[model samples]
Target: MRDATAEKTETALDAASLVTDMAKRARAAARVLASLNAEARTAALRAGAAAIRAAAPAILAANAIDMERGRSLGLTHALLDRLMLNEARIEGIAAGVEAVAGIADPVNTVAAEWERPNGLRIQQVRVPIGVIGIVYESRPNVTADAGALCVRSGNAVILRGGSEALNSSRAIHAAFVAGLASAGVPADAVQLVPVADRAAVGAMLTAQGLIDVIVPRGGKSLVARVQSDARVPVLAHLDGNNHVYVDGGADPEKALTIVRNAKLRRTGVCGAAETVLVDEAAKDQLAPLARMLLDAGCEVRGDAATQGVDPRVKPAAEADWDTEYLEPIVAMKLVHGVSDAIAHIERHGSHHTDAIVTEDAAAAEAFLSGVDSAIVALNASTQFADGGEFGFGAEIGIATGRLHARGPVGAEQLTTMKYLVRGTGQIRP
Candidate 1:
């Protein structure tokens, strides 16, 4: 028994060493990636898109295995939805890659240039952020999206997807590797940790010097663990308790449509609305909206005022206000006005995404300015918070943190700026 325990310890050490080595290779490859011309990087992404399309059959098969396992594990329907991938979804992922390839390369772009009085010229130019470690959950599409976004921005990435999607992520990552090779970029530039062990996640979190930044993409638990345990800087949001507010001036028709799409279009996505705040002045509209959601099969949990408006609404518990349902469930509340709505969101929101459905310019401006969130919308569905919807091709993830990056983190957000100074033999004295 002692020998067996020692063997297990040795295996754990081997895995840690392997992960460290992977980070080292990624750092080296990052330099190569950053030096590559924009055209070369774009070619790699385009090639990756093609490769993914070609491998759709294999990817789907791998997804099937994961789906079967998820079902047996009694994973929630929302999670199952995130885990399942069909041919159409594969095609969508490929299209996202292609879109990213078409975006303007951020590397070497001069953000600002200034000339000093003493004959020195200073330029702030964008550069890759070096190695980015993405630790994500069951969504295999994130593997392709994160890899493409990093390559597009000239940053090497190390992907650590959820264990449940290991087979699917591996299959998708193979396409990224093939594309990188075809474009003459180092395959190590975009690598997925082949092991699914939980210990590997710990190794990634502690790789401070090796990984320049860690981006965690998933539910609150995953992001919380990464944020709390990671020795490296993490770009992530702890929760996406997103909210949609219907103002007194909101058009009844538009509010109903936006509410339906925001909450029910795809509840599994992080941008999906979990809470609905209705202005007390517009309380009359609540019954119709609640009925619409219920008719569409969404379960509505509401405060007393909202429940009074609609008999179908279930009484909401206190915790519902702070919850990210990520399912076909929504919490509804009646706010005194725009100010109360803003206060409610600021108190319970995850600062991820929030929306205001109003035609009143003053109310819209107030809500937009008052709400402290990464992405705030006016007269639009909160689902528009996506990086793709923001026209960046694809996103690594939505960062609610106020550090280097925020909102939909695409290729541009994956870069950092450095000052480049040029002087012709100027002496300090």
Candidate 2:
């Protein structure tokens, strides 16, 4: 009989082999994808959208299974909402795919061109990063978005979704494959692992040469794991421990409107505001702000000052200042001004998204300039931090890292650049 250690080693070996095969196939497909012209790739995206629309019933059914399993596993209401799929949501996904198809192709375009002193012509051209692996959780929509974005940007992708989302992801992946097949694109160009094993995630992380970059779209724990263990570089989507500051010079109406939408528009999203910082000048309006959120069935936790303004406002713990709270809950604090608000956000925020609501242009600019987040907003809802809202169709995720990509990762951001040169033979002086 095999010993436990030996069995473990064999399993690890099998996982590694599986990842290696997938990566090799993906690399070969990427070469084909990179060679295809813009029209061909666009047609593939259109076809994928059509396939998704055609497969909506099957996709819905698959999502139903996932939802059932999620509930059985006792997933939180927020996660269950993310895991659920309805007819409208499926159509929205299809529309997003079509929207991506309409975006200008980023491949092979010259970003800049210059002439050298030696009469050599030089051009900076955008090109695919090649073979991207996406790891995500809950939302099966990512399966479609990541695959479409990678294909649109002329790269092959390997997707490893969370176990709770396996069935839903498979259905969407089939639609993507149909789209690729219809366009005569290699089906291997967009692959989703068949298993739900954590071993698969580890395999992708360690498959450095095989996968160019790993883009992880999930909660903090998953991103942390990928960051710590992956041999490949990671594009991290951070938790939305976001904030909105109601500046003292703020217009009260706009402040109320933006704050309400930022916090309640969709609590489960990464852009949803988790906290609010009110300028002490807005102290008179504080109770009204607390009341608005409370009326919307949101639980408001606040500091002593905020709690004093509204009896319904619960006392906040220090940890509340830093929590993501991806639900109908928000923490409120009073700041002296834009500077104090900026300090609070800098200290506790995840640097994902932050907004300042004020009619004061000076305060707005200060907040925008001071907060070093992926997305900074002025007099607008933090929910506006979406890629679609940014007119990029669908995003892989909001990258908080200041590397190759930040904010919404669209097709253009998915690519790296190369230098193209044309030179006449000139002897050195």
Candidate 3:
């Protein structure tokens, strides 16, 4: 008889082979997608959105199973929240897909044009980045967002969602397929890996020639693995240790409201503020802000000065400065001024998103310029650091790395620029 362990190993290898085959199919589909016009892509997205709305019952049923499994596995409340989806959330996801369809297609758009001295007309135009591999965790909405964005930008996508959301992702992917068929696009254009094996991720990471770019949308471990092991270029952020600084000139009411919403509105999201920096000059506001958080059922972790303001505040350790608490918890510290806040964020922040609540334009500008993050807000909630808020419809992820793309990875960012030079048989010197 064949060894059982060996058979399991063979099965895993087969799963890897399956993933590679999907990558190849996606590469071929990308050519077809690239030839499609903006109108055709929009039609496909709209079809997908309609399919999602029609399939809400089935999608929610799948989500319920995932939620039950998550609870049994002892997942955190935040993680479970990311996994669960209801009718309203599904509708929102569909709307986001429609919004992407409404946005102007980025492919073939002229970014720059000029005439050269050598009688040549040079124009820089955007083009699709070919096949993209999206490895995400928990959120099934990413299934719609990533597929729609890739289709809108004229690229094919291969999605590999976490096991926790496997059923919901498949349900959502079916909607995408229906949309593609409605628009006469290839079903392979947005293929999701069928197996939940870890080997599939490894195969995707190594499929350098088949996958043009890898975008990981998950926690630090997931992003770190993709960045470290993937042969393909990665566009991702390791963490969202975001911050909100209450400047001396900030309105107390604004600070309170922004902080409350930024931290507690939806704690599991990447835009949630993990740290609060209060200007020493605004010491009086500290107690009020801390009290508000306490009243809202948030656990406050603070330094000596902040802890002195409220007895409910727990003492913060050094590790809290660099942690991304995806929960109803926040770390607070008092800064000497804007400069101090900037220094602290520069040292501890994950360069995701940071905000300043200040009525003083100069102070706000200083904070905005000094802090090095993907998204910097002035008197705004850090939660506004989203692609939809930026009018991009939906985002694949927020790229914290400063390279080909930064901030939100939307349809426009999914494309690369190519030089379209026209001349009558002009040759290089």
Model 2 lDDT at residue 190:
97
Query: What TM-score number comes out for model 2?
Result: 0.98
Candidate 2 lDDT over residue span 13-42, tens digit each: 888899899999999999999999999999
Candidates 1 and 3, the one with greater lDDT: 3
| CA shift of 351, model 3, Å | 0.2
lDDT winner, 2 or 3: 3
lDDT of 3 by residue, 1-429 (tens): 999999888977887788789988998999999998998999989999999999999999999999999999999998998988999999999999999999999999999999988889999999999999999999999999999999999999999999999999999999778877887889999999987888789888988788999999998999999999999899999999999999999999999999999999999999999999999999999999999999999999999998998899999999999999999999999999999999999999999999999999899889989999999999889998789999999999999999999999999999999998899888887
Which portions of model 2 miss their true places by more than 4 Å? Answer: 427-429
Candidate 1 yields a Cα-based lDDT of: 0.92
Each model's lDDT: 0.92, 0.92, 0.94
The collision pairs in model 1 are none
TM-score of each: 0.98, 0.98, 0.98
Q: What C-alpha lDDT does candidate 3 achieve relative to the native structure?
A: 0.94
Among these predicted structures, which one has the highest TM-score? 2
Local error of candidate 3 at residue 33 (angstroms): 0.8
